[model samples]
Structure formats: structure tokens, C-alpha cells
Target: MDKKHLQTPSQTIGPFFAYGLTPTQYDYEFKSWVDNNMVADIDAPETIEISGTVFDGEGQAIDDAMVELWQDDGEHKLYGRFGTGTEENNRFIFKTIKPKSVNGQAPFINVILFMRGQLLHTYTRIYFADESSLNASDKVLNSVDAKRRNTLIAEKVGQKYSIDIHMQGQKETVFFDL
Candidate 1:
């Protein structure tokens, strides 16, 4: 990722659109999660800062990259899928609530990144706070090779979280390849 913003194409390649891709709230069930019930909403006015410069293995910020995130309802929602991309505008700020573990399956959030001028759209899944014991038990994280697991986590910094993504560079985030 380069510190300086680079120009990328805004042309739509599929069903998703450009920035501010409105997360359709077609599923009524998703409402529960966005409401104050979910953990991310716990601190109503407290904004969890999710800040990170997308970087390449060489340690350069990738500019003009759009990042989309989706996560499950952290409030014990009986029927939410963590990585399925089913939650509605579960799209809160780029910063999200810390995911929890269930059934020995640690939670994770989906991320879709669009870079300017790049033909390839990158897909990745981000894990919750690594400090939690659940980080050790997350099935998704566990499934990945130990050497690559670190690529899936983001470090939380006070009110802001930071994770630099390396696009077109070595040591990139673990992409879903979808």
C-alpha cells in the first residue's frame, strides 16, 4: 500500500457499486443486529476508530482502495452467519465491534477491497481482537496455515484500529479468492 493515494477505476464490474455501496436492508432480521443490542452498538456515541493504511510487503500504502466489511451480530444472535456475508447493513463504520466465539468457532468478518485501476478485486476475512482467547480457537483462523494467520488480524489502537493491506505485493492479507 502506498501512502500517497493512487487513482483507481470506479467502473462497476458486477452487482456492487462504487463508494457508499448502500447495504440493502432487505432482510428484516438484520435489523436486530444494527440496533443497540449488538456489541458494536454498545457504546452508542463511542466511535470505535478503525484506521489502517493499506500497505504492500515493501511497506507502502495503497492509495484510493475501497474496503467493504461485513460481520455477524455480536449479541448472541441465534441465526447470524459470521462469514456468509448475510448480515444486512451490518455495515457500520469500517471499525466494528469485537467478534465473539461460539461453539468453539471464533467469529470473523468479511472484507472486499476494490483498488483503483486494478482488475482484480481482493477478498479477505478479518478476525476479531486477537488478545481474546477465542483467537486461539477460531475455526477459520485455525484452518489457515500458521504462517499466514497473522495476515488476517488487525491491531486495535485505542478508538482506532489499524491494518495496512499489501495489494500487488508480498505478504498480502489472506484473500478468499472468490
Candidate 2:
């Protein structure tokens, strides 16, 4: 063990996150070069748009936060990434095909939230509302309370899905350890 190489404590997700995480999506010269894309194939099954907001413990929107989604690309492909651009730090959207099960588990989109005041990114999941039956038996979902589990489930809109992320307070989304 080298004493001079001690690890530093985690810090808040600061201003530079946009440039580092989703420069093209969040910032651009003439127009945004990146989008909140979810599917890579036009033939993907159940493609839909997902939109939501990120609220703090005090119920305030966090416009600077960056949301990222990772999931199986509705194919045999292992995983994919989407930079859910910060919609004025109030909301983010991901236009993607619904993912299938991975390793016999319930289908879900793994989410990473980077925001100010959080020393480390928060990890959560976005489960489809249509898959309520499957969500009931998910090992990860089962770990949480029956009532609180709803926090992880998205609500299906007409042609899109909605899933908000509550950072704290009573209806806080279930976060996981990485």
C-alpha cells in the first residue's frame, strides 16, 4: 500500500458534467448533435418514448443533472447507453425500444443519475408499467417493499412512458449500491 496514493473522497457532480458526460447532447455549436436515443434498429420491438423529471427532496427540479440509461438493445446485444439529456434540469427523455429480460430477470433499464449535491451518482431502474406481472417477481424489485416498488415502475402514456426520479423524501426512488 502506497501512502502517497490514498484515494480522495467522492465529490458532488459539478458544472463540468455536461462537457464530460453528454457534450454533444447537452451542449452544441449550432444545434445538438446528440439525442436521447434508445434503440439502434428500426425493427426493434415495442419502441417507445420515455420522459420524466428529477426532483430533489424539497420537490424542486434539478436542471443540471444528467441522466443515463443502460439496457439490452432489445436484441442479443449485451448493453447500450443513452445520454438522457437534461431538459432544463427539469426532465429527460429517452426514445428507445423496450428492453428484454437479461439473465432470466425482469426487463428493466438501468439508470445512473448525476446531479449536484450527490457525492456519487445514484443508481436506479426504470421498469415498464406494462410488465407489472414480471416486475412483481424481479429479484431486485422483490428486495424493496411492495408499496415502494411502484417508485421504480414507469407509467405508460398514450405513445410514451413516464417515470420520474425522486432523489429523496417520502416517494424517493429506490437506489442501489454499485
Which portions of model 1 miss their true places by more than 4 Å? 1-47, 56-59, 74-93
Candidate 1 per-residue lDDT, tens place, 1-178, comes to 8598977765633433322232232333223233212344345454344445566456755444455565664553321112112333222235345555556776766677765555777788766564557778777777788887877776776665556556545576777765
For model 2, the local distance difference test gives 0.75
lDDT of each: 0.53, 0.75
**Candidate 2 local lDDT, 1-178, one digit each (tens):** 6568767877887856666556676554444334476555456666688888888889987777777777764563323333434465567877787777777678888888777778888899899889877887789999998889989999997879999889889999999986
How much does each candidate deviate from the true structure in C-alpha RMSD?
A: 12.0, 3.7
Q: Ten residues in a row with the worst lDDT in model 1?
A: 77-86
Clashing pairs in 2: 63-89
Candidate 1: C-alpha RMSD after superposition: 12.0
Highest TM-score against the true fold, candidate: 2
On lDDT, the leading prediction is 2
**Residue ranges of candidate 2 with Cα displaced over 4 Å:** 1-9, 30-34, 40-45, 73-89
